[model samples]
Target: MHIVLSGYYGFENVGDEAILLSIITALRKAKPEVEITVLSNNPASTAKTYGVQAVNRWKLKEVSAVLKQADGLISGGGSLLQDQTGMKSIPYYCGIIRIAKFHKKPVFVYAQGMGPIHKSMSQFITKNTLNKVEQITIRDEASKQLLVDIGVNKSMTVVPDPVIGLDASAFRSEWLERQAFESGYISVSVRDWPSEVNFKQKIVESLDLLARSGHNIVFIPMHDEHDEKASFELANMMSEKSLVAPGNLSIEEKITVIGQSDLLIGMRLHSLIFSAIQATPFIAISYDPKIDAFATIANQPNIGHVEKDDWNGEQLFDKAVDMLAERSSIEQALREQVMTLQSDAQNTALMAIDTFK
Candidate 1:
């Protein structure tokens, strides 16, 4: 089978890259003879990294040509369908699906976090485009509810974030040692939010408390430059010393780092997902509904919402301490979910691939 994959690819964001890796891994494992192509922002780099044929996502001619040669297109595992972040992607991704439909090929929506899509135009386009797909596998009930509310009554299933099924054995524990970082860290994954809330300051204060208690604080950036900048900014404000992990770590390396953490207090959905891949304990901070949504799915603590919670981030430190105390039970809860999710995630690929028949 030849499949053309699309989503927020070729971007420097670690979360999307992880999703790409997971989807590619799932597809190949489901059908070892599968041939893959990617629609990416940076086609050359994505092609080189994943060892797949790639075309610039913005080049409609190239994307159309690629789709013509493939068996089908797989369009997500991320928040690609939502417009609260921006409206451009709804039209862009939907347009790609239409291209595949024009070729009379199958298209699958793969485990996307589909909402908080408030704009009427976005809802209209999303409902229309998605209703036509062969299958729609969303990551959470909230996303499925959003799709149903928008009137996209398709064959959809809610599954765990596909990254939860990512092969953790591939994670290189030696990579962290090579970077001269210690294990058993309190790994933190964070990003910038558009709100005026000073959540960063609150997070810094929480880390400072953890650091004072002799726990090593390591800020793991999910995106290279942007997250590294956020990490440094937070670390610089801390009364106690904290480390910003070296930038440009591969997806596998990032997982290794998070997996080895004593606890992860994270904002990025995939970072928390990384923690789950290895059964590490975590406390999530929700900048978006997807963050809290995954936290709930993983049975972890989500201290507060960035926009609606206390500016002091007192709950973060408290949750971290409590999670540390109950690590054994927490790990068990995560393991049960991880086992089922891994199977479901793999089957999701099988389901998508079977659509070709």
Candidate 2:
């Protein structure tokens, strides 16, 4: 069967890229002969990276032509339906689903994370478009609740994010050797967001404190272009020596790096996801609700809200110190949670693919 997969693909965001990889891997496992096509921002690179037929996501004529021949379109495993990022998000994703429907193709809304859609128009578009899809699976309860609030009463199953199902055994790295500068390290992942100007400085100050306490700090840029600048800037501000990982690391490499860390303090959702998959204990900095939700579900502490003025260096330092002291127990708890999530994530794919049969 042929399936057209759509989302924020080819964006070089490691989290979204990991989701794409996980979905394709799961689908292939279910149906070995399945043909997968991706709608991506960078078609050529995506084609190379995922070894799938990729078309420009923005090119309507090209996308419509592909959808005409596909069995179904799988919408997402990320926050594609949310307007918190921008007004265009909901319309863009819904447009793709509508086009697939127009071509008489089945569209599965796969493992989506729904709104912070505050606008009436976006809500109307989401409810109407989602109601037409053949099947829907969301990653969290909040998403399902949002759908219900928006009047999309269709049966929607809650599944873990696809990244939770990624097999970490395939990738392994020696933390000390790879980093070369630190014997033991904490993995820090950061992204640029519209926050107070001192946020970055505070993060650096916190990491510096950790460094003084004898933990080497490593900055991981999950999105190469967007995050690399933040990672480097934070690294530069630290009084203690730190390293910013190279931007070109593959998903596996990134996961391995995260797995090897002693602990992770992350702003990116996927950074926390990767930490969980690898059984690395993490402390989340809540830049978004998704971060808070994942932290709550995984039963980890969210140090503070990124948007709130109360998040400061001292609070972060205290949290890091507390989590570090309880590392062993924390890792065990994360592993147990991840095991359950992995099973659910796998079942979600099987259920979605079963519709094709």
Candidate 3:
């Protein structure tokens, strides 16, 4: 089957890239002969990286032509329907599905994390578009609930994030080769979020305490320069030394880096997901509901939310200390959850493609 894949692609964001990777991996494993074309912002990079045919997502004629020849379109495994990211997000993704439907092709909504769709127009359009799609698999219960709240009445399957399906056994990172990592280290994944609170200061203080207690800190940036800059800013404020992961590490490499760490303090959603995929102990600081949702799945502590001005340095440090001491139990708890989610993610891909059958 010829299927066109769409999402926030060709962006250097490692989280979205990992979603694309996991989706492609699962789909190809389920149907080896499936022909895949990606609609990406950076078509050449997307094509070269994933070894799939690619077209510019913003090019309407090109997208329409591609969808016309394809059997189906797979529209997302990310937050494509949210107004929080931007006003255009919901329309852009919904528009793709509409174009596919216009060409008499089935469109599968693949493991999207829904809403913060505050605008009525976005909600109305999303409800209409998704209700018409042949099939959908959202990443969590919250996403499913959001769709229901927005008036999408179709039967939907709620699965874990596709990235949960990545196999860490085969993961390898050349970046973590050192004595500090050998003893034990913490991995942090952070991003710039708008807030008046000094959440950064609180975190810096917390990490310093952890460092003084003899734990090494390693900052793993999930995106390109943006996350790297966030990491650098945190590291600079930190009195103790910290190592920052290079900007060029691939998605697999970032997962590998997290896997090697004793604990992960994650602000990015996929960073926590990576830690869970590896069964690594983690502490999630929620900047959004999606972070809290995934934290519950991982069975870890979510210290607080950034936007809510809920940064507690003592609580953050104390929780990290507790998680470190109870690492075995936390890992034990996550193993079953991670395995089940992985299986669900893999099966979700099969279910998505089987819509055509």
Candidate 4:
């Protein structure tokens, strides 16, 4: 079976990369002899890293050719159907699904997180395109609800995010010794997002407070290039004992680093997801509804928007301290939830490929 996978691949976004990694893992487990092809922005790197045939996602001719030859196309496990990022997002992803359908190929909308699609045209495109899929499995209830709101009344199951099922035991990093990470080390992952002007400064204040309380701070950039600048800027603003991790760490390396941390204070969804997979307690700094949704699903506290007008550094610090106090119980709950999510993620892949069988 030749399956073409599509999404924000090759963007160097750690979260999306992790989702691809997990999806590939699950697909292979279900059908070891299946042939895989990826539509990616950076085809060469993605092909090399994932050991699959990759084609440029933007090249219409190449995409059509792949759709013609592939047995099926798997759309996504991320926020691909949303227009909140831009108007192009909805059309671009749905366009691929439309092409696959044109080729009469079975297209599975796999574990997708649906939108904040506010525009009427985007909603129409989403509902019409998605209704033609062979199967659809959403990653969250919010996504399913969004689909309904958009008038996509097709049956779709709610599954866990693919990364939740990734096996962390396969990757190891010597980051603890290399960075001299200490006993009470807190892993902080931040990203650049449109927010209140003083967001970075407030985050710096919270980290400073955490450091003063005797916790070592380790700044992790999940996407080396995308996240590095913001992480370094925040690190520079802090007077605390802190180390900014190298930006080029692999997905496994990032996971290992989060696993080794005493706690995770993160804005990236995957940063929090990795913490859960490792059974590490975390406090989410919400910048998107996806973050809050993940926190609610995992039963963790989301300390509100990181850049809200009334953003309070003291409130964030207090939440972190309170979460740390109950770390043991939190970790236990996270582990139990991860086990269930892992199973759900695996089922997502199995269901996607069932059409081939």
Best by lDDT: 3
Span of 10 residues, lowest total lDDT, candidate 2: 173-182
lDDT of 4: 0.89
Model 1 worst lDDT run, 10 consecutive residues: 175-184
Model 3, residue 144: displacement in angstroms?
1.4
TM-score of model 3 vs. true structure: 0.98
- Where in model 1 is the C-alpha error above 4 Å? 173-175, 178-183
Clashes of 2: 0
TM-score of 4: 0.97
**Clashes per candidate (backbone, < 3 Å):** 0, 0, 0, 0
Tens-place lDDT per residue, model 3, 1-357, is 988999999989999999999999999999999889999999999999999999999999999999999889998898899999689998889999999999989988999999889999999999999999999898889999999998999999888899999887987876665433557889999999998888898899999999999998999989889999999999999999888889779888899899878899999999999999998999998888899999887788899988766567878999999889999988888888888889899998898789755
Output the better candidate (1/3) by lDDT: 3
Candidate 1, 1-357: lDDT as tens digits: 899999999998899999999999998899988999999999999999998988999999999998998899999979998777777989988999999999999998898997778889988998889888888899999988888888988867998788988878766856578656443569999888876777888898899898888788988999989999988988888999888887698888899899988899999889999999899998888888898788888888888888875646566788888889899888888888899999999998999888986
Best by TM-score: 3
How would you order the candidates by TM-score, starting with the best? Answer: 3, 4, 1, 2
In model 3, where do residues sit more than 4 Å from their true spots? Answer: 178-182
Error of 3 at 89 (Å): 0.6
The pairs that clash in candidate 3 are: none
Model 2, 1-357: lDDT tens digits are 899999999888899999999999888877888999999999999999888999999999999999999888999989999889789998999999999999988888888888799999999999999889889999889889989998997899988999999889879655435557536689999998887646788788899999999898888889997899989988878889888888778888889888888899999999999999989988898878889889888888888876787778878988999888899998898889899999888887788787766
- Which tens-of-lDDT digit does each residue in 97-152 have in candidate 4? 99999999998888887878899999999999988988889878888888898889
